[model samples]
Target: MIDEQIFLSEQTQDIYPSRYSNSPHMIPRADPVVYGSDFSNAPIHRELIEQYQQQGFLVLDNVFSDDEVLMFQQELNRLSQDDALKQCDEVITEKNSGDVRSVFRIHELSPVFSQLASDFRTMELARFLLGDQVYIHQSRLNYKPGYRGREFYWHSDFETWHVEDGMPRMRALSMSITLTENFYHNGPLMLIPGSHHTFVSCVGETPAEHYRQSLKRQEYGVPDDRSLEQLIDEGGIVSAIGKPGSLIIFDCNVMHGSNGNITPFPRSNVFMVYNAMSNKVAEPFCSQKPRPEYICSRKNIRTL
Candidate 1:
């Protein structure tokens, strides 16, 4: 279970109630507009844009090489066995009995991760999706052990919690990179397309509760207690199953979340969130703050 106290920190400023717009239902839809007109001249194929516009997400196969994945995975496993990582008791949480889940802020822990966080291929794709000047706001590794466990509640990363008119575009895109193969049987990610544009008030609630309510409001017909598998069969939901080197990049507004690992092996992955660096925003919502330099130094790095 997520610690409720963490929500009260000032660093989590981007997450708060809005004074400008009423609840999601009351806010009028902005005029329907096609994106990617002026900002990025780089030839992002029409299909890629269409995919994001229609589904709120897109998958890139084999973004990392097999050797790279193996190296990163080895490094992560090594870190897991280290006393330093184990001593980060504050960031670690327990679920479903004694199964401990470690949430490591990768940029601070691993050089490889920090280098990859600002990698060119990633930044260029981000620039295409968002605009120029992307700042990596957060990076974390979730290590979920194999076994029976409480599911990770479904929720959006950008939902407001405390401040009014939260920072605009503070988090524009989030990239989830699977360190290991995330097959359907191992609790892969499941998301509802086009749910990003629909705002939901999820303050003070667990992810599971927020997800259930969102589905009901959307009339998606997903039962509150249904497993992710059950929801997928009903239609529209997509499971992001891929090889270890693949990645799924989606807008922060997207409604995305995952379940617990039921397979005998552990399910592990690293998540990195990037935001377009602009002056229109205030402080972020989470206590995991990034340095000002890190935010300002982003350059366009493209890989062919």
Candidate 2:
């Protein structure tokens, strides 16, 4: 077994440089849930739930307005340039190096981020997919610049994030919304269909090891390969390409990752991971455990 501390240090090195980059640092805004009580009645919202379950993923085109996407992108860019967020610059994955120069929990940064982190549409969708009692577990903005080679390896989000027996196959869902145009050239998101139903255990590996293996694979390297296309042809995978404002919702257990950007411009997106309140599973035992941070700011929310 990997030593817990060593394992954690590796994972930490794989993600950001230190704990400060991952912990919650933003203040919360007024609760958006208080704005209305009839969220379950939204038609498109209902459709989102059905589509997610049937296909194991759903793409909502133009879910955010172009203006909204631009605004968020501006904030992300501004924050990326700040000294506080840039402290962990050396440790970020190569794929995320450009836009995500520094990593900070969304809720710890600003009220707008906080509101979006706990948006009603998102929370409602989470409840619909996982049940009414759901919690926002992790959230981050993934910044990808054009021409960067740091693409993630094909893997399930749940594989490394949950306890063994107590794992909930469909306990959580993740939402990735593009803040900029995402196309084949810009490393759009990719997913393997029905892989969520397969039980594959992801033993905790150092982030560095994960990065090295991904870099070695030609499928993830430049000049784009046919492997992803073949998967799509075989009905095994799907490419999620969309303009800014589109959202892709998928089961946490689904096998997914992105290719590196080969375009001239950068692509940016924000992600939030929500786990059904009913499912309380611990992360798999790692000799070196990277402590999980709260995505939502509890201090800002007025408990009902």
- Per-candidate Cα RMSD to the true structure, in Å, reads 9.8, 11.4
Write candidate 2's Cα lDDT for 23-89 as tens digits.
2111111112111235466435655555555566888897788888888888777777676656542
Candidate 2 wrongly placed segments (more than 4 Å): 1-48, 88-104, 163-169, 202-234, 281-283, 290-304
By lDDT, the best candidate is: 1
What TM-score would every model get versus the actual structure? 0.70, 0.69
Clashes of each: 14, 12
List candidate 1 segments past 4 Å from native. Answer: 1-35, 38-40, 96-100, 160-166, 203-235, 279-304
Which has the greatest TM-score? 1
The Cα RMSD of model 1 versus the native structure comes to 9.8
